[model samples]
Target: MQNVTVVDHPLVQHKLTIMRDKETSIAGFRVLLREIAHLLCYEVTRDLELEMISIKTPLETIEAPTLKGKKLVFASILRAGNGLLDGMLDLVPAARVAHIGIYRDHETLQPVEYYFKAPADIADRLVIVVDPMLATANSAIAAIERLKQRGANNLRFLCLLAAPEGVQKFNEAHPDVPVFTAAIDSHLNEKGYIVPGLGDAGDRMYGTR
Candidate 1:
């Protein structure tokens, strides 16, 4: 898929494997998730535009290349997404943050929005939506839809793991929004969970389920 990017870096793959293990404790899983997120974030923003600016160093003034245009906006797709959000913030502290709270209806498997808050100038910045898992794509599609309704144009989706079905649905729903993932696992199960996924992301991260 043209819109999908899999960060296969050694470090990212290693951490992802550890995270996928059923024996990994909640504390350990959270730590590994954060570490993997940092690596994935690097790949997600690798193509950001840069502009030259004059800056004075300790010795002399010189032209320096800095990120161009408005500061980026990291949009977290609620609870589990925050796991990736926390680590990404460590890399780009200046970027604005947004939280999109959406949940899936258990029976219908539809998305339900509960809360959303984004930067006022969302239209002018690149918005990267973060989520730990992409299983059904219902929440992801709805989250991006909400962002667009609020005037966000430039957008991308980032996740720790993705199922092929979810990716296909997401691509069909929003072809313009590229997806970044550390790994794309097997198909989803009958219960809508990724076959080899790390279980419910929010549940695993919080030890709730």
Candidate 2:
């Protein structure tokens, strides 16, 4: 079974607490979101492959381990994902970014893809798919499926907050990919929103609502 890492770092928890407060100002919320994203990205990339190579030091040559292969390709699930992308990029400044937009049909509640763009050689690079909230898992799953169709085999999922139901559904559907989140909430409400979630991430991030 693939692992679902819920980051318990003190900083992550602290930041999340602030972000959840209804009184948190828009600027404050935005800053905290980025900070938490950077912290989570650190833990998610801990096991990235590395290779040792000889390099010259001030005095003599020495072997030092450096990241191996191509740079990471971050596939953001549209507007909300862009919030997370800014922070992740701070950690891996050279990472390539892709965008995917999906919306849920009001009646059928099915995912509908509006946009998708990725690096030409996604299959050869580590791909991290990101979104702020993992609620119904419809958008995340659909985004993953689209990436797979584009030849992305090395992929993982990342989010700030997730519902247990969404996590279970996504993991069962894509057993080969792992998921990482700052916190996992209890469940989704009838309207498909995660309880105690930070609300619509795209709305909060862009002041859309």
Candidate 3:
């Protein structure tokens, strides 16, 4: 995939498998999502710029590498995105966060924005959009679009699973924004759901129908 990176690490894959099982409890699903997010977060942020600065160690003074540039922002696409956001925060504690409230109209599968909030200086920071499933890509696309309108140029999309159709559509819509996912599933189903997907991520995590 040109702009898409699949995180195929054993831990990520293993946790995803457990998440996909229908019998997994809500608590278990939430825990696994956070764990997988930690693993995936590692891959997405692997290329961050680092600058060396002098630091005093127990025995001597040494120059240590630390992240360079402004703090990155994590733009979450509503209820489900929060699941991934929790773990991503665990990895990047200082990263800023943005919440975009967009819900899928079950009938049309279109994204309808209800609320959006973020830092004022997003234009000078890297924004990583987190949404667990990219089945239709409607919400993710809209969320990124809104962020760009707010001056966010450098951005990336992170998801736990993606459908082939969703991935292609997302790339076409935002070629400049790269995508990172744990797995690319078969395809989207009739109701705009990903086949072999673990079902509605929000519902699963919240124990809702």
lDDT (C-alpha, whole model) for all candidates:
0.93, 0.90, 0.95
Worst 10 residues of 2 by lDDT: 102-111
TM-score of 1: 0.98
User: Which stretches of model 3 miss by more than 4 angstroms?
Assistant: none
lDDT of 1 by residue, 1-209 (tens): 56899999999999988888999999999999889889999999999999999999999999999999999999999899999999999999999999999987878888899999999999999999999989999999999999999999999999999999999999999999999998888898887888788899999999996
Judged by whole-model lDDT over C-alpha atoms, candidate 3 comes out at 0.95
Candidate 2 on 1-209: residue-level lDDT in tens? 14799899999999999898888888888898899999999988999999999999999999999999999999999879999999999899999999999887757667899999999999999899999999899999999999999999999999999998898899888888899998889889888889989888888777886
- Taking all chains together, the TM-score of candidate 3 against the true structure is 0.99
Write down the worst ten-residue block by lDDT for model 3: 135-144
Candidate 2 structure, TM-score to reference = 0.96
lDDT over C-alpha atoms for residue 162 of model 1: 95
lDDT top scorer: 3
Better structure of 2 and 3 per lDDT: 3
Instruction: List runs of model 1 lying over 4 Å from the truth.
Output: none
